[model samples]
Target: MRDVTIIGGGFSGTALAAHLLEQLPGGARLRLLNAGAPLARGLAYGTQSPLHLLNVPAARMAWHPERPTDFVDWLRAQGRPAAEKSFVPRSWYGEYLGARLQEAVRRRPDVAWEHQVARITRLAPHAGGWTLFDAQGARAESQDVVLALGHFAPADPHPDLAALASPRYVRDPWEPDACAGLDRDAPVAIIGAGLTMLDLLVSLDHAGHRGPVLCLSRRGIAPLPHRDNELQPPAYDTPDDWLSGSDVRAWVRALRDAARQLQAPQDWRDLWVAMRARTPALWQRLPLPERRRFLRHLQVYWDVHRHRAAPSAMATVQRLQAEGRLRLQAGRLQGVQDAGAELALQWKPRGQDALQTLAVRRIFNCTGPSSRLSQDRSGLFPALAADGRLLPCPLGLGLLTDADYHLLDAQGRPQRGLRYVGPLLRAQHWEATAVPELRQHALHLARALARGHAPAD
Candidate 1:
């Protein structure tokens, strides 16, 4: 009997586990491990607030691609009517994930599936298999293992903010009760102006926070809102001569020109979806220098367009802006210091010669997940790197992996039985973050593991 273990109970981990159950032969056993994150929800879907909606439409979120409308069907079965194009509450999607996992377990009772709530710190090779050491001094073994650790925490770039150990400072927005103790009447400042920043804004509104909100980032641009209309495939082909250039500036111009041809920003969304479908191919064709240049200059602009916000949530942000309750600043954080109930912030605005200061009751780090594994304080990656079990991508975006999702060792050789499937694949595939991309990886990995393809070494 083959034994397998998956660490992390988030969307990637849970989907992989469910697919594995169906693919593995009888008598094989599997274990699913999770620690602090809610089962099947992870950080993205852990929010219970009604305002936190899935950025993608309901029809495309099925764990099984063969059943493309499974999520919408599930909603109807539960007496909740939902359309294929509707953006539903994230909490409801979390419920769908939980139900799918339960169904997978129910169908394969002979597999001896189990869920363990524990945090893993280290992994070691043992007798042609692997042993995991959890936080409580417990150990578990499996013939094969997959590390679906999802996204890592954001890096604290500022030295002063990183040194603080006060209640007024929140390093992670997903932490339990992050905004619970905040003073409603006192102003709050957020360190990033991205998707996470938007989520926090919705949360504050739900809690009835009436104080002014401050948003600071190197680029003060928030993500554009998704259009309510259905998006169609590209109507015309973007000629090779038009987009064959390697310069990022020219590429941006080409996209804007294509959007203008469609005659509406709403049509731009469809154009974006088509471009995203080919992003991996386009990214792979570029040289390493060009990729680096794009990351440094155009990544933020691409992000704001690619990953959009829900219409209702976008409306909330617009409302806040109209009332002058929200402010966006483009600058770099210079320092932060404690000042009684409030914290003082110093920043140097872009294209300016002077520093600015502000005091706020609380500050949140919403810079999104840090892509560099070397900067991760977590013990998992460090241990793997120390033992030559894993190698960092050349761009430092994530773990280096081959085309088959097998992680690379320190010497840059693919290590079988040690697989990965999540946003970390961004280093190789530029569009790996969203569910549509991740589900393909999960299905392919599951099929490979079922065929007894794991390497003994």
Candidate 2:
């Protein structure tokens, strides 16, 4: 029997397991190693709040690409709202993923589907396969291993304040009661204006928090909201025209010119969809220098536009802004200091040299995922790097991988029998994060493994 082990039981990992099992031989074994993260939920869908919604619509979130309407159909079968364009709660989606995985295991009783809850910290090549070692020295061997370790927690952006041992400071918002425990009457400073900040704002509002909220980020830009209007793909220039140059600035100009041609800004969303469809090719075609420049200078703006908020979530944020309860600022955090009854957040505005300060009762970091491997706290990634089994991709966004999703070694050669299917592939493919892109990768990788035909590197 071919034995396969998947690390991290998050969305990607769980989905990969289901798809792989469906295609594998009847007696193959599959092991799922989950490190504290809820099976099938992962970081994105683990939120308990019903206020948190999927960025994509219900019809587009199928775990398998071939079954495009599987999620929506499941929702309908359960008598939940199954509108094609509706944004559903993430918790519900998690349940759907879990149910799907259970169904897969149930159908293939002959295949040993072992689920283990442990943190694997070390990996070693053994007997033409691989061995995984957990914290307690427990070991498991498999013929193939897939690194589906989802998103990494954002490192403390302002490391100076990381040493503070006060309950008033929260470095990670995903922790239970992170924002809920804040003093309801006192203001709170959230260190990012992206999706995570929106989530915290919604959570605080639901908890009846009436205090002023400060949403701070380097760019002070918030994601645009999806509208109820139907989505129609936009027709931009021919591939020859858009792909003519590798200059980042030229590409941005072309995109802007295309959007300007349309009368309304909302129409730009169509162009965004088209751009996302082409990101893989566009990203690979650019030289490394141009890719780095895009990340350094244009990533924030691109993100705010590319990844939009659900209509309902955006409306709530807008309502909060109109009520004068939320303030968005552009600045870099300098440091934090103790004050008489609160903490003083020292920061510098976008263009000013002088340091400005804000006093708040509590602070939370919502700066989103950290892509740098050096910042990974888990001992697993560092071990891989030390063993020459992993290499950092360009722009430090994620690990280096070939087009076939095979993890590259220190010498830039694909490591056979070692695969990766997660957001970290963003380093090689700009559109690797969202469900639509990820599901395709999962299906392709699984089919390849089952057929014993590794994709060409």
Candidate 3:
């Protein structure tokens, strides 16, 4: 039996595997199953576009916290030295992760490590562990299973929009050749205004598409850009007393008050960073009603500020906007229809009484990952839910997991020997998506598994 079977090979899975290999006992066998993106370069970092850059600076992106400069050190050794504060292309980061995984494997030849490209569709409880089945009828038994399944593609925002399924309507912008075959000068519509939309803008520019690109979302607020010198961490006064409350409005008021007192406008970014360490606790403190209120009202604003883009990428967006090649608008997309030779998008502009139509040659859903598990088309999650092996969060954010990241079952019992670590932990920890937070999760989970705390029945 496999000592540990990891169900995804994205960053979270790869990082956990590397850590486990370093800590697991000799003679232990580990298996990594990926649905076919490269082992380390998952959807986020697998882009081939050189213009797609890491939002975080190089100094802070290392997978292992103990070796904070591991990424930078690797870059230097590759003869491609980058400043500690520079935002490097994401592909390079993917290469770095691949190298790290290989190093971990090479360093521990005593442990058996195997990676297979398989799409896991279901998991069955067997002999106190799990019997995992892939799409090909193959099966594997493990003493412990870790679900590091990364982000799923965005769900169709509107029911009507889903019905108009044509090649012109791109469901996932990350898919290869997503923008292929588009006329160079034809207008395009993107269904989001967040970091993913910004990435699409960069991609469009890289592809030499000079057509006007319209980005539409409910709020139409784009992500803020990072400061050029992000290396110097700013000072922000922490309001510990104010943060103890469970009221969302009170928390927002405190944040706004603190923002007003920032030494400089850029210091607001630092203020957000200062609040990062406390977000998960604050989120947990709130009653479910208050959490729902925050999601309904404040999530967009919080996302724009918390998840800022690289200055270079934002600069490209601004340049395109200034050139009349890009446009950002606040609106709700109502529906889509076939317009002769083009697709017509019907949307209601923010604060407008009347709907308007925009015809574009192509429309891409640049909206980020789907948060609702009910909309998950992947057979894996639905199967898990049906078997009472997994429980979806009450808020519909992600799966429910305990403090140690053990997945909770339908009856709210923590499933021993079964765990998860990824953005889905957002169900419990509001700020669990990024690399910094995920790396920590990976490390903690790895340490627990290595300690043999989760024994097979």
lDDT of 1 by residue, 262-371 (tens): 85434777767767767888787788899999989998989998998888888889999998999988989999988876789989898897989899988889999887
The global C-alpha lDDT for each of the candidates, from Candidate 1 onward, is 0.84, 0.85, 0.88
Candidate that scores best on TM-score: 3
* Per-model tally of clashing residue pairs: 0, 0, 0
Q: Which sections of candidate 1 miss by over 4 Å?
A: 231-236, 239-242, 264-266, 375-378, 453-457
**Reference-based lDDT, residue 348, model 2:** 89
Considering only N, C-alpha and C atoms within 3 Å, which residue pairs clash in candidate 2? none
Please, what are the lDDT tens digits per residue for candidate 2 over residues 34-131? 88878999989999888899888887888998998899999998889668888889999999999999999999987889998999999998777888
Error of 3 at 158 (Å): 2.4
Give the poorly placed runs of model 3, Cα more than 4 Å off.
Answer: 164-166, 264-266, 453-457
**In candidate 1, how many Å is residue 450 off?**
1.3
TM-score of each: 0.94, 0.95, 0.96
Q: Candidate 1 has which clashing residue pairs, if any?
A: none
